[model samples]
Target: MAPKAKQRRILVKLVSTALTGFFYTTTRPRLGEKLAMMKYDPMVKKHVLFTEGKIK
Candidate 1:
């Protein structure tokens, strides 16, 4: 592909990612929350146990 076309494609991809991030934060925030929960649920349990031990 030509350099100009490649640059345009990259720009389009960047815009698409930005729009998706905006929509996730504004319209579908629960999706981000669920993702966060999934990512952290395991660590949260471990953290709680570690903190409880530290208090002893």
Candidate 2:
């Protein structure tokens, strides 16, 4: 018997800060995970920081 590994790859959403609630899924590492990234939004036509957390 062997222990199961935690999910190494996961689908996370990058949310827009413009309050448009626009989001898209991205692949990320689940181990020691702390993800904060800027992504482009078509509605706002600008980049916003998307953080990893329980979706609000």
Candidate 3:
């Protein structure tokens, strides 16, 4: 059998819908899945639901 994948964290970008501000974070997706999280956007000055989207 093949060895397990090494744990690795990569940088990701999350953007706010209201202010269009971007937040940078890291995530480890071993199975190759997108990361979705609800975090606080400082520019918006509130909590918002941010999903995995293209940075460019």
Candidate 4:
């Protein structure tokens, strides 16, 4: 039987830093540091920093 291939990407939650209880979902490489980006938040109506978080 062929060996099972490893998953290179994972689903993660990006939470807004503005404490607006807003978040986003995206796929990223499994082997790397936590992801962070600037995204628009509808709650605040402005761009904010989003940090990676667990899906659970």
Candidate 5:
């Protein structure tokens, strides 16, 4: 039998910068840096920058 390896991915919350209370959950590499991307926000009806936030 082989021993189990540690997880390399973690769940992160991407929050909209528009302050519309919109967010998305996704898995990412366990890097020590934050993630950010541009996505469509239905609340604002436009694309906006989404920054990484703690899942808790």
Candidate 6:
């Protein structure tokens, strides 16, 4: 594979893995808050709350 194509594949895999982990955090609400703090955003916590049906 070309260098550019290989790099793209690696980037895609990394993004996919990170997204999977983020979704997993939603299943564990307490841990999700910690993970959200690590992300330096309030959105992750909001998403976790929404996913848990704590918010409409």
The lDDT per prediction is 0.19, 0.73, 0.67, 0.96, 0.94, 0.26
Candidate 5's residue-wise lDDT over 1-56, tens digit each?
Answer: 99998789999999999999999999899965789999999998999999999988
lDDT tens digits, residue span 1-56, model 1: 65642221111111112122211111222223212111112323321111100111
| Model 2 TM | 0.66
How many residue pairs clash in all the candidates, one count each?
Answer: 0, 0, 0, 0, 0, 0
Best by lDDT: 4
Give the per-residue lDDT digits (tens) of candidate 3, residues 1-56. 99996766555666565657566556655467777677887776877877666656
Query: Candidate 1: where are CA atoms >4 Å away?
Result: 1-40, 46-56
lDDT of 6 at 48: 29
Ranking of all candidate structures by their lDDT, best first: 4, 5, 2, 3, 6, 1
* Pairs of residues clashing in candidate 6: none
Residue pair clashes in candidate 1: none
**Candidate 2 wrongly placed segments (more than 4 Å):** 1-5, 53-56
Displacement of the residue 26 alpha carbon in candidate 6, Å: 20
lDDT of 4 by residue, 1-56 (tens): 99999899999999999999899999999897889999999999999999998998
- Worst lDDT run of 10 residues, candidate 5, spans 26-35
Model 3 spans > 4 angstroms off: 1-9, 54-56
Say which prediction, candidate 1 or candidate 3, comes out ahead on TM-score.
3
Q: Which candidate ranks first by TM-score, i.e. highest? A: 4
Once superposed on the true structure, which residue ranges of model 4 sit more than 4 Å away at CA? 1-5
Number of residue pairs clashing in candidate 5, backbone atoms closer than 3 angstroms, sequence gap of 3 or more or interchain = 0
lDDT (Cα, tens digit) per residue for candidate 2, span 6-54: 7877777766667787887777877657677898878888888766655
